[model samples]
Target: MDIPAALGGVSTALTIVKQLNDIDRRVDEAGFKLRIAEATSALAEAKLGLVDAQEDIRSKEAEISSLRSLLKRKEETVERSGYRYRCDANKNPIGTALCPVCMDEGRFVLTIQSDQSGRPYVCPKCKANFGYLSAFQDP
Candidate 1:
């Protein structure tokens, strides 16, 4: 009877040890899962930041393109504004000062056409009397 009781006690102790080992393993697995979750959250935040940075870059690029276009138009206007000139009797170019009224209105049209048979030259758009030539360089 004593031997049988000792064997029974040993079996119970072994069962308890097995239960403790299983509990320890479960705790270790839970800790690992928590670390994975934290890492995943960090990755998601980084991706969001990258997307914002890309959008900023795109907006700046578009603004730069618009400014470049405006600059080109301004340069063309400056080049055309030089040397006051007007049209001739046959709608041709000759050396004459451009009408101030037309130039002030952001236009380069010249008053060269003789509307009243040999009267004072008149501008087409503003009808100003003076040399108002067409804005185009060609005739």
Candidate 2:
């Protein structure tokens, strides 16, 4: 054909190819940005789950500490008077001759005998006297 017309057609073909290359590059960049957004969201959700697990562990530790304190109090009561209950055949408890004087010091000293009327119980271990306590004190 004519020389000028052939050069014009070649120029149009080169322009179309350049436009297609630009569109391909923009599409690849958009895909990469979308993947980055999704990964960021997943990481945030994982961090929230870790925080929840830590709170649960703290609450469990507090409950364990409270239970330990209650156990210590029960042990102290048992050491103060372990065998103070003397139940009869009808399950009625009779008072023991525990001296109140030594009990204040966390010692379980029993008086060997009492007066005839059961009052003024005397303890031979510490040489102390005490009145008769009720049977319903602590078992």
Candidate 3:
């Protein structure tokens, strides 16, 4: 379970194997039994590690599913708030329809013309017009 306990088990197994080897040097049947027992305990430890790895995989999958759902909820909220939404960049407005610059998505707006450039660009939020600078100056 804990590191210290795990290490302790390993130490015990090694000690048993070493004692069995000493007995083997003296040519006895009891040493063979000790070796078999130690090998069985090591196999059990390997099975426990396999189980822990499986649990870790399941935990990570659950976390991924939760994050996916959260992202979906946020995307729906943004759409409901009337932000211009477009997964693609090259979509042209239907008829004179345009997206509000505030929303930045190409939805729910009347068709509008670009500035003197005669291009087609609408604000994401209001879909009125998209411009970086006003044509008028106070100075």
Candidate 4:
């Protein structure tokens, strides 16, 4: 499956072909049969290498698609009133407030913990304290 092994297989096949071409009509039948078998084996190895390379390409493509989806979701999020929130398809903010510090660092959404009064208090994830916000209340 390694690229170098695949290239080596192709090189071996080519060498066999050249040798076969250079052989005179007086060459023994058994020796020619052996060379033909060797060439067949080399070609098979090269084919396997090509298959493995194709598989690797497909795997990488799938990973890229998944990452793009995550990035699109992240972009859909909104920051408001010193907090981060995920948005709906209509661009309306939804769910609990996320920690602004974690969001700024490009970390995963870490919901901010609030007091019983629904006021911004602290972040459970990053442990950031938002002390005594008299004006800011979670709705």
Which candidate number maximizes lDDT? 4
User: What is the per-residue lDDT of model 4 for residues 37-111, given as tens digits with 9 covering 90 to 100?
Assistant: 999999999889988988888898997997777677678876667665677766566766666677656565556
TM-score of 1: 0.38
lDDT (C-alpha, whole model) for all candidates: 0.54, 0.53, 0.50, 0.73
Which has the greatest TM-score?
Answer: 4
Q: Candidate 1's residue-wise lDDT over 1-139, tens digit each? A: 1333444444554555445555555658775555455545545555555566677778889978977775553344322355355444454445444555766655666566565455565767777765443344543
For model 3, the local distance difference test gives 0.50
- How many backbone clashes does every candidate have? 6, 0, 18, 0
Alpha carbon RMSD to native, model 1: 22.9
Off by over 4 Å in 1: 1-27, 79-139
**TM-score on alpha carbons, each prediction:** 0.38, 0.38, 0.37, 0.62
TM-score leaderboard ranking: 4, 1, 2, 3
Candidate 3 or 1, higher TM-score: 1
True-structure lDDT of candidate 2: 0.53
CA error at residue 53 for candidate 1, angstroms: 1.0
Where model 3 places Cα greater than 4 Å from the true spot, the runs are 1-26, 79-139
